[model samples]
Target chain A: MNFDFTDDQQAIKRTAHDFLADRLKPDKRRELAEAGSYDDGFWNEIAELGWPGIFIEEDHGGQGLGAVELVILQEELGYALAPTPFFSNAAAGFLIQQAGSDEQKERWLPGIASGEARGTVGVVSNGEAVLVPDADSAAVIVLVDGESASAVEAGSAEVESRDTIDSTRRFSRVSANGGGEQLGGDVQAGLDRAEIALAAELVGISQWALETAVAYAKERKQFDRPIGAYQAVAHRCAQMMLETEGARSAVYYAGWTADNEPDTTPLAASMAKAYAADAGWRVTASSLQVHGGIGFTWEHDLHFFLKRARTDGHLLGSARSHRDRVAELAGLSRAAATA
Target chain B: MDLTLSPQEQAFRDELREWLEKNNPGQEPSGEQDMFKFRREWQKTLHDAGYAGLSWPKEYGGRGATLIEQAIFNEEMARQKAPGLANVLGLVMGGPVVIAHGTPEQKERFLTPILSAEEIWCQGFSEPESGSDLASLKTRAVKSNGGWNITGQKVWTTYAHEAKWCMLVARTDPDAPKHKGLTYFLMDMEQEGVQVRPLVQITGESEFNEIFMEDAYVPDENVVGEPGQGWNVAITTLMNERAGLAFGSAVAVKLALGDLMDLVRERGLEEDPIIRQRVGQLYIEAETLRLNAYRGLTSQMKHGIPGPEGSLPKWQWSDINQALTELAMDIRGPEAPTVDERWTYRFLRARANSIEGGTTEILKNIIAERVLGLPRMR
Candidate 1:
């Protein structure tokens, strides 16, 4: 009957938050961003620490936590923009764990939890062009063509990740041939799980962005006023703060519903994903807007959140798209999740 | 989200549900029935049976249970489609105000009967002059003797006809700040100078009233709080009022759906995509509202009594209701132009759903400025 965290869940969240904050080095983040690549050593450390595997079975080379735990761990990682293909891999791993057959889980689960296998769900691509994140970094790409699942390996990097607005987390287009196995499972199932997870990720990203913006507003002063003291800046940031919190609660409940097997769960995912995309986009835009002139500059890292947020909004699906799916689930029948 | 009730909360809900079922007189066949009176006696029964004031302090003769238990009580009552209570103002608004800011005497004198429906309460804030611009209210309460002499006109005072007491807000010092110079009082609606005029609505019913006060005497002891701090006390009532009990709104839409579908089948339009699409849209809108309700409920459980995010659900609900009823009217065709007791009446009546509590435009502004972080009007 816990709509939220038990004390044990809260404690795990606290530990995870503290662990990442304590372990992440600003210098390391700078090194990875500057190099325009991930630090494999950092990836190994994350895997060995079992942060990414919080929900993966221990036998699958991971920790055996749950959906809630994954949400907490991703939150900390997102706070730091720790250069890892986490949102992708964890989302993919959890989706497979929920909907995949034993053959499918055996094929990719261990590698993903062990950090040896990197995974990302590719929703729309023609192999000629792609808008997926970290396609270059990913080892196995879970591709969805509306309602089917397949693994496409990006063997040749013909597609390029153009100059992106978000400098911190990288996004790229994918064009690969001689690809991988086309697995079988419910594509919407994977999409729904990924949708719920992405919504939760947006919650993390939105919160960090709002908190950072608020802190920045307080610390950065103008006209002898903590710009936050000015109703103009303060209220906008306040809305961002509120929307972030509201979206977080919605996303958490979606995750909670997934964990609990509630009677009507698709609406939870739809509501979360729709709200996450809508709120993530808004808060990120507000974040950039609040930073003003400096925020407009490339030198300001504030643009990082904006880029990732915009990309995440459309990653699995946009809010409108998810909402339409919600309409289908809620209006028509509950066969989508089961189907 | 694991929203199952605890054993005791479940038991409490079972008991409440059982009682409501035995007593529940599904809405009367006649539109002109006295629901308020029926509901009042029922509430008195609840009070006597010890189910009222679930989260209030025991000092106020409440059960003094946890907020979760109160929430369970609300959800259960809402689910059962129980008769609306006449003491809503007393239970949801005035009692909370009295408990929080009322003197010990006020609590002892007001709380017990209010819960028992012995004294129905009505709010007096929205006036002919002030609505959303509430701080600009001109209701005047002049200092006189050991108390005050009030003279004001208040509109949209819901259920004032049935109420014996009114929660009044008046300007104590208009010369002070717009919000600061106010006083809140417990007014006697039956006083010599207090008059309540029915405000007829599109529903063709005086669901609320416009009350005029000329030299209405209110003793100092009846003041909800310090004289000039009335706005603060008023806000306490408003906040609790907004903490929310909106659930199962889909039921009304469900009734509408049943009626509409009967009409659809009668018109032989079941196969029509146009008709189907309208029903589908209405169904989806109703479903979306429910999902939004769940979203709000889940948040309330996590974050406590909903912040301004509460504005989002109310705003969305109004939109859905307006859109649904409008579409239903369109589906009813030229017959919609004709008003009757069937779907036409409901369509006409549901229009007020957007106006009551708050207007849709005002709600959107709240969503934009409060929830969406748009700039406030300068």
Candidate 2:
């Protein structure tokens, strides 16, 4: 019943933390965000580390580590706020691996795994999957409409750039028809894993924001005392810890379930996603409130976290939708029926 | 992180489960004394099977269970809706304190009866005035003929009427500082100087009591640790209270939530979008509490004490349980306020969840000043 990372997992986390710290400095990340593009050098370095395929099967030209390892990387990357295609590519990788046909796996899984041909998954609505991250650069785009999924080559889809409030990553509007083979297996299971990945990222963002807020509260004094001594600011920080830890607990559990307890993954994934989406945005916003005026300025780095949190909360699914799923899956439907 | 138990832990759990199944005492009688007697008998049954004092070391007449086993024990007990042991305060706090700091004779005198439920114990830490600022308590014990004469009032004393021993803390040095002058004494509750008056709560139950200790006698041997070190001993008791309660509290909340879900389904509200969202949110909150508790338990096992996150589960449990009841009422719709249901009573009971343990506001202050490194307000 240990709820701690293993020694090997800790090593992976430390490696990711150190690499991102060294490579994705604040100025570098800001520059990439401003350009609305990922640096090829940074992308190539991450690819060299075999991070994209950290969770893909070993026989599929990649590492066979599970979702726990994948989340470690995603969380570190989120903390760094690095402008890379790691998340979108990993989202695509999850769908292809979990839901793709054997033929589709042979065609795209190798490239996605090796980071040679990066991929992204878009949730299709109204014949277009808007806000599809890295669609312009993605080689394969898996457009998901409900339980059905189809992998569309970037060349065959009409991809238009979609600017968003969060510049740390790029998004695109993609529409494809009469192209790309439909995923033959369970699309919902694949999406559940994807949602778990997003949830992990949200947890990371909240953790970063919380640390930043705590650091600021300790140093930023008012009335000849650190404002944190006042219950107003202090309580806010405490509440942030509560929310962050709550999201973290759910995310970590869901990540473990994805790898070890597949039968429980669907419900666990939705719960994690629902809790984290709200926590990710709320904690950062509260952190901003603690910082007060300086946090409102573009010059401060807190806004970046705030924007990322807001964006992540609505990425694959809103908290409301996930909560509804949780309601159904966690036994509310039966209760209501009997009622 | 592996959330599943190992083979050894699973074996321990299965064995405990089998024993519970075989020796299950069923429900307690309705009367207060009858319930207490029933619970004492149940504790005796547990003691005979070596299920009591699961966290104490083997040398101290306990199973010497690992932290995981202790957690599993709490979870299973909550799952089974087992009756609480008659000497809960002793098992959780008093025995541990004695083992940690008492003389060898004190352990011999106190530990076994606590396990067997032969001598029930209750806490006498809070007073009407001291409450959250326990060190500021005015309960004073003066030097008498080779013993101390304790004279003061203690409020919120649970099980005072049924208790044979009261784990009482009082001011031993009138001239010493508020926190430095105290002493912890194992006072005999079955004495003329001791009085226990039931303090009826909003729930219309006398679960707690107000005690007036008029020159209660306590020999020097009964003092825990040293004189003038009661604050530290009390802190240990409080920490133990918070750390050990999280898992049991989480399981209890989950059990309540399961019942509420049944109510939701019974009301045919599961198909309602708004109701579904609220229900789902509660489920997420409850699951988060459960997971965070396990994480906190793991941290405590590694570090020998709970981290700041350990302070969380109680606060979260209070909120989640309260919300579950409120949602049950909401699901009941126009019939919500009707006393025809169990949730109305549960909803009122949950109001004390935050206030009883430690006020939610006080918990925030602890997290801020101690955990977050915030400067103290001078």
Candidate 3:
């Protein structure tokens, strides 16, 4: 009945937290975000930690950790608001590992796992993936359309850089034009795992926003005392805490479901993604509200988090879409016969 | 993180589930007295099975279940929709308080009756004037004849009419501070000076009552702790009220959600996109509440003290339950206002969830001041 991390999982979380805090400090993150580029050296340093392969199979030249460990790393990445290709690469890894054929896995899993030749995944809509993160830099790209997915080498696809409000991560519009190998196994399973990962990231962003808001509320004074002493401000901060913790619980449960309870992963993942998508944006925006004018400016790091949260909310699926899926999975069928 | 029940926990749950399946008294008859009688009988059945006071120590005639087992017991009860025990307040708060703070003689006199449902208990903490700021209660207990005479008005007391004992908190010392001057007493409710009047709620049923105590007598032996230390003892009772209830409440929400989905389908509104989204959101919120409760339980087990995070599930549960009932009404559409017993009753009753147990505002304040270390509004 324990819902806490094991000793080993706790160690992984602590290590990731410390490493990200040291490696992707505010200055370094801001530098990369402003430049609209990731530092290759920084990416290499993360690769050295084996996080890129955190959930890939050991036989495929990677660490055979579960989704829980991947969630820990993604949460830290989101908290640091680091500018890297980690999420995109991991999304690709999940797709290829879960849905790729034996031969395809042999060809690409090693590269995706080792971090030497990375991959990215995007949801294809109307023959084009409109918001593919790190598509231009990936060695391979997995384009998912409904139940099916395909792996296309970067050179075989048309990748155009797309500037987004979140400059911390790069995005590209990708079109493979039927020039890729189709993944043969369960694509929705991989997508569910990816959604859980994204949800974990949102949880991290939410936690950061909540902490930032609480700290600011305590230190900032208005009229006679700290604004936090006022219920108006304090309750807003408390609501943020509620949402953040709720999102965290959902995401962690989804991650555990992915690793252990396969049958429940789809519903669990959608619940996580839906709750977190709303919570991530709401908490960050609330934090900005708490900061007043300072949070609105580009100079404050809070904007970066806010933008990232908004971008993440729409990346895999918006809250509305995932919620729609949840309704279907939960037996709210549109078919009249069922009703 | 392992969310699955352990082997022992699973066995315990299975045993209780089987027992409930066999001994389950299907449903309570409608009238308040009839329901109370039904529940009293059910509690007797549970006591015979050693299920009542399952969390109390073995020496006190309990199973001495671990926290997880107690949580399982709660979740299963809510899941099976089992009839609630007649001595809920006694089992949850009074028995635990007596065990923690009572004298040996007090334990011998109190604990067994609470388990057997021979004596039911009700709390007397909230007054009309001191609902949230409980320490400022005007309830006065004047010492005389090796006992005390209490006089005050207490509101929002559940089971007051049927209760044999009142876990009353009153001011025993007028000169001391508001918090320090209070004392906890096990006041006899059958006395001539004590009176209970039903407080009709929005649901038009009196699940709660306003207790009027005029010169209510309590022997000095009935004091659970030293006089002037009732505040701390009362805090223990409040903590007990909050603990081990999250799991049950979460399950209850899920069950209500299931009923809501059924209503949606029965009305052929399941296909409506707006209804679907609302239902989906409710499902997500329910899951979040359940998971957060599990996370809280794990942390409490590890730390041996529930943290401020404990405030979250109650707050979240209130929101989810209220939203769920409102959605049910919305799904009912033109039929929403029509008196449909179950859903209509639930819709009106849910308004008190955020206010009762602890208001959502107070919970937010606790999270802000205690959990986040924000400045207190004081």
Candidate 4:
């Protein structure tokens, strides 16, 4: 059976990519990132492009597409390094659509799609990683507790800046103080959705990192040969390709699980998110090495990708956490068997 | 981005899965003769079912389906524990080359029977003198009349005794550079001077054969390409050989895993955390392979042929197999030293998996030199 992007899907993905390319320039990305102006304007741009709406219903001013569209959107954002609230708002907006009441969606979903409001989900009460399109600037924060969730307004929370390897994501420590509206149902399900979304984001980042590395390797020459012509570098690029591919597969399985197999989504997301986190870090590291010394400098374009990779490497859950999650799933199965 | 199948493809997958769910080649008796008959019959059945030539054009009696369909067929085939394909030389190499590089007459002569399973073709490579140094082989196919006289020994020929044809590579020029002198030929294995003797392997079965030739004759019509350009032609065959689906881990597939588990369980060793951990480790390796397969599939779906990234899975798989077998054999305790134990059978089989398609060392070299951009060792 065919396991490929449909023509319509491809067309939409092309449109999103073109939209990103047309709207964001390299200088603007640099300027915004420098100012740390991760804000509502960029969020508005993506929301206006109907990205946040892809998972939302048509009546809620959304596109009503599924996990496939979500992937296309994240990949485009990654391609641009757009410094937008796309990842933050879209993912949180998706959660709202999932567990929020009809009244909750009616009140916030439209504002999210229209850029009047933005949101993000923090499965970890406190995390040090900065690995999304933009996280610190979101207006609303969805926090998960076991199988339950609470939506805390960012402006109301007492926050502390955390030590971070990646500056682009700009994460913070927050004290929710039990001061928020709880999401519907158990906290574990909500945490699963949030983790899976982060995994999808990492998949996009890893893919983009691999492509950039390959292109860079092909262009940068040494000793009368393109670095890519050398097996050490070429194999790094190849391994990056392999990891990106692997991440993509894992993300897809997780994405599919997210939409259909919600009960198994946690296990699948753990696998996907864990693999993506590790792979993204690897591809980014390999890209930097392939770039050589120039990649280490902030002036070079390579650090930008590397920074995001470093940020995302520990976001949502680190590779170890996801591995533990997998172990937990296995543990559950064994215990259930004995019972 | 989307993973859903079209109605037709879904129907095809369902039909194919239903077919595979019932038919299994592993059920064939382990005897080489019995296996050969089973293989021929299975190929015929696949042909009759229009499942042959999965990626070939329809006129060649193939299904002429998309690459994914071919992938599905291969995946399902592997899943069903089918025998290694009977028509690989034809289906994977011959069919592709004939379509891309073959003469019209060659296609007309070879295409149908290949899909029909009428002729089982074996690969003639890996001479005793030229294992990793295949380019330096001295297999000479000298021009005598309108044809050629091939004088060489081809060792490690898989089932050549049962095969009707051989895809042979020989040195057409003794004076040229090592790679420059090579030529590719699709020769009749049943011809005079062609002697195929099955080598009783360490497994106590002669599954593969060695061919000895003394001035064996081949008509000019069978020549794959220009006489001096055989090296280039041979590269095409090698490239085709290098290309195939990634199985990731030998222990990953459910049946394979189950069988491995049964071995551990039958030995009453299930309580061993080390055994459980080893199984878990094998599963992760398999999952890694599965991830690589998906990545390659995603690339193919969204971009193009997955390229060298596809090779990493197999390379890692073989390395892990060698390790896994060593571990399994270790767990089997003292009974594993010789062929006295079933685990040793797996150890031997694992050894062959690396050597057969490509050796672990060569694959590592390829990954390093070609994929990684590392300098090659002299």
Candidate 5:
């Protein structure tokens, strides 16, 4: 079995990489983060590129691609640490496409797919959805609570803007008292695919952090030699590689499983999410450690990656929560608990 | 990227599956000699079916299977819980090394017996003083009338007592550099000066042995490669040991994890949050190990050599296996230290997983220095 990407997939990856490199340059990201707002014009350019609808069906006015293609774009965006509403928008699209009824699809899929009407997703807790990313800008917001999901119009929900440690993206707190229509299909399937997307983003963050750390280790000198000459520093970088690669493999496999083997998606996606959430935070923190004093400062771009990784680790679901899901899906069946 | 087998690969797998279903040799009996004999006969059955040395070249009496087929064979064997062949070292390392480096005479005399398990092989690379730093091994050999006379001590030599030949590396020149002076020799183990003493490990099992060679005879024809080239030859065998073996080990860990879940259910400990979390962590680690191995295989196929991550699967396997056993023991709780047979033996055996093939420290060093381009610690 070959794990290497196909020619088409490789072309998508290369195009995304070069495009993000030019569009999401470090200065642009820093400029947006400092302004505490993303460039709406630049986001329209991304939407025009059809990234938000990369996984949507052709019947729904979008590219009839799969989760693998969506993951490739998300990974590049994560690597650039771009200040955009891509993930939030994609999360809403996934839930609607996977769980929406015929009427629901007809009503919202076209707008969401064409990027004319952006959407966001948040987990509902006690009738309030916290950390609903880009909710202020999204037209439709899907709030999931347990097995059921509801789609609320932004005006109908109490969308209070909230700022987090990660300035790379905006978030909001939303409250809806049965304000929106309930989705009638399998919400868990949609959530699992969403988790795989998040895992892929984490893989990208970890890769970036690891490359930054390794490059730093080779140049930073201590006691008349590169710090990398010492096993302590070298081994730290090595461990980062292990974690990053593990996350990457898991994410890639999960993405493929979501597209090709829906039955295996829950377990594979949980494993990917759990492993990558931990890896993302750990590798970014380790890179910060390798950079020493400079990494801790706001002047360096490393802090942005570290903050985004930590925030992403807690987004959608924490690593511990997904790990518990892994426990259940991976043969420690819930039936055993009751028995 | 396709994770499923192609039509040809599926056909190959189905054929092998049918053969195994009909000719499966169940399990081995208890006694050491009986077990060895049972495995030897099993190897003969496999050899007759063209499964033994499945990856060896057709010129060397092999099926000339592709690397993916070899991986499938390994995975299927592990998945079926099939008995291991007696001449594992011969089929995996020794025979491959001979095919890669041996003379025509050596190939003619060695390949067939190894496949049929008529002549079992054991490696003699690790000495008492040369574990990780193998180049420092001081096993000396001097030229005699027609061959070399070798004197050395080799530890952790599995199957030393039963092996007919030892893939021995020895110093041929004392004055040369540590890495340059060595030679690779296929030493006959039946000579007068050779002795094998079983080393009982922590599990109270004699799975490995220490061999003392006081001028053991090695005729000139037994040398696999030329003199002053043992390091390179030994490295080839070591690389073979690491490559293509990960798929098998990953499957084995997965099987153990399944057993662990069964135990968790049986003991009604599945509801315990701590045990569930531990099991979940182990599951993630195990799946990641499997995925990483597939990625590594892809890189190897593309580059014609394993990439830096090739050092990874073994390290991940050791960690995941150890954690799985530890969690099983924790679930056992008060019964952890008791002689519960399977779990206890596994828990203790897993302690050597990290130390056996290569230490975790050495693996990290390899990754840091070779893979990441870090300066050497020294």
Candidate 6:
């Protein structure tokens, strides 16, 4: 059993890494984040790269890949903390593709895949979705609330822009009010895929935070030698490595299960979401601790990552909610019944 | 990436599973000596089936299985709750070191007996003074006629009383640096001037012993590698001790977690949200450990040697096992302090999981210095 990516997958990852590194410099990301808006130029460039359609089927005017490939791009975007509509658009695509009717797929999949008419997805509770990313600009918005989802044309729904601590991407409070078409397919399957996608982004964010901490530890000296020489600092960095790597393992395995092992996806997706949600916050917070007072300032790029990690932990599903699901899926219910 | 086993691997697993199903010896008896004898017989059975030394080279009387195959072997054995081989130290560490660095004569003399369980082995690297800093060990070996005279103390030597050979490391050059003056030797444990005393642990068990060697003689041919290079040889043994064990340990943790879940249900605490959260966290950690191990294995298969990432699974395993046992006790409620036998023994024994092979602190140091490229404290 090989746990590494295939040659083609490796090439996709390297390409994404180099492309993001070149296009989304720290200053560029800071400019967009500070401006509280995304650059249409950057979104168009990513769309030209066909990343928005990386996992969409070729029949729908897309590249026809799998969840693994989609995660590769999402991870790179998270690492760069790039401000784009990629994730929201992709989330909508996954839901429509997996849970929509044939007519809904035909109408929305092509536009979502081409990145011309982007879509966004949000979880609804009590008829309102409080945190729908990119909803203001989405061509279509998919709102899901337990077992059922509805797709609404952006103009037909109410979308009020909301500012989150994570300004790298935009969010909105949405309400469709019975104005959209119902997606009557496997909604949980779509939600599971979306959870795995979020988990991958968290892995990327954790990796970035870990690398930033290690670099800072090696360069920042105190009382004579680099602070890393002290176990107090070094052990924190080590703990960051452990959490980041563990989240990574969980996310990658979940992505693979989504593509190859359908029956295991529900359990695997919740595990990934649960582990990565906690790990993202913990690793980034630990990295901030490693940088001391500087990490606390707005001038440092580390805060952006820390904020993104915190916000991401609450999006789609919180760690506690996913852990509850994991308990049920992993045989807690079965054990209780047997007892 | 494909997580499923290949056809050949599946076939290998099927064959081994069938064999085990037919010849499973079940559990060992109580008492230390009885368990040791039972394991020895089990090892003999494994040797006859060509299962002992599964990862050693074919030229050295082994099956020469691939790393994945060896991992599968470990996973299957642990899955079946099979008794461990009596010559574990010999097969995993001693024979591998000899095969990697021994002369033809040394290999011929040492390989077969270890597989057959005719000559059990124990390790002598740690001392009371040299627990974490193994290079500072005071065990000394001096030149003699056709042999070397060893004198010093070694603690935490498992199975020392039953072992026929001790894979000993001694300072051969007193004038050299602490790490450079060492030599690796296979000392005969039956010789005079050698003593083994059981060291009772917190669990009131003497699974480990202290070895006292006052001028114990080891013939010149007993050295596994060149003189004064014992540090590197010992490193090889430590690496072997860590490699490929993750899969087995992961399976064992999974089994323990299953039992804990059973206990949780049996205690009527399954409806407790806090208990459920704890169980869920343990389950996730256990899975993370297993997945990380597979990633490490893939890296090792590509790079020939495992990267510093190998430390991750060991650290994770210790935490998971400890947390799991503690949760079991918590579920046991007011009866936790009483001797419930299985859970109590496991709860006490798991305290050593982090301290035994390598302390969690030392593991963190390794990951920080080696994996994360942090500066060394020294």
For residue B48, what is the lDDT in candidate 2? 96
lDDT by residue (B165-233, candidate 2, tens digit) is 999999999899899999999999999999889999887788899999888899988999899999998
Residue-level error in angstroms, candidate 5, position B270: 1.2
Segments of candidate 6 deviating more than 4 angstroms: A334-339
lDDT winner between 1 and 3, please give it: 3
Name the runs in model 1 displaced over 4 angstroms.
A11-36, A79-82, A99-107, A124-132, A144-190, A208-243, A286-296, A333-339, B28-33, B58-61, B132-136, B142-147, B171-181, B202-204, B226-229, B246-378
Per-residue lDDT over A122-193 for candidate 6, one digit per residue giving the tens place of the 0 to 100 score: 999999999999999999999999899999997899999998999898999999987898999999999889
Relative to the unseen true structure, what is the C-alpha lDDT of residue A49 in candidate 3, on a scale of 0 to 100? 83
Clashes of each: 0, 7, 0, 25, 0, 0
Per-residue lDDT value at B149 in model 3: 96
Better of 1 and 2 by TM-score: 2
TM-score against native, each model: 0.80, 0.98, 0.99, 0.82, 0.98, 0.99
Write down the lDDT of every candidate, Cα atoms only.
0.71, 0.89, 0.92, 0.70, 0.90, 0.92
N/CA/C clash count, model 1: 0
Candidate 6 predicts chain B with a TM-score of 0.99
Q: Of models 1 and 4, which has the larger DockQ?
A: 4
Chain B, per-candidate TM-score: 0.90, 0.97, 0.98, 0.90, 0.98, 0.99
> How much of the real interface does each model capture, measured as fnat?
0.16, 0.93, 0.86, 0.22, 0.81, 0.75
Residue by residue across A227-293, what tens digits does model 1's lDDT show?
7656667657755755676567666766666666644457777777777777888997898887888
Summarize candidate 6's per-residue lDDT along B1-378 as a digit string, tens digits. Answer: 999999999999999999999877998898999999999999999999989999998888899999899989999999999988899999999999999999999998999999999999999999999999999999999999998999999999999999999999999999999999999999999989899999999999999999999999999999989999999999999989988689999999999989998898788777788988999898999999999998898899999877656679888999999999999999999999899857999999999999988899999999999889999988
For model 2, name the residue pairs that clash: A335-B265, A336-B265, A338-B266, A339-B265, A339-B266, A339-B267, A339-B268
**What's every prediction's RMSD, in angstroms?**
5.3, 1.5, 1.0, 4.8, 1.3, 1.1
Which structure among the candidates has the greatest DockQ? 3
Proportion of native contacts in model 6? 0.75
| Candidate 3 residue lDDT tens string, A114-183 | 8999999999999999999999999999999989999999799999999999999999999998899999
B-chain TM-score of model 4: 0.90
Residues B1-378 of candidate 1 have per-residue lDDT tens digits of: 356677987887788788878877666344434677678777887787787877678877889876566666766666666767778878988999888888888887998888888888999999887987888999899989988999989999888888889999999997999889999999998989899899998777777889999999998899988888988998888767655455545455555565676676666566555665566555545544544455565567677766455555555566666777777677677778787667666677777777767676566556545554444434
RMSD of 2: 1.5
What value does the lDDT take at residue B362 in candidate 2? Answer: 86
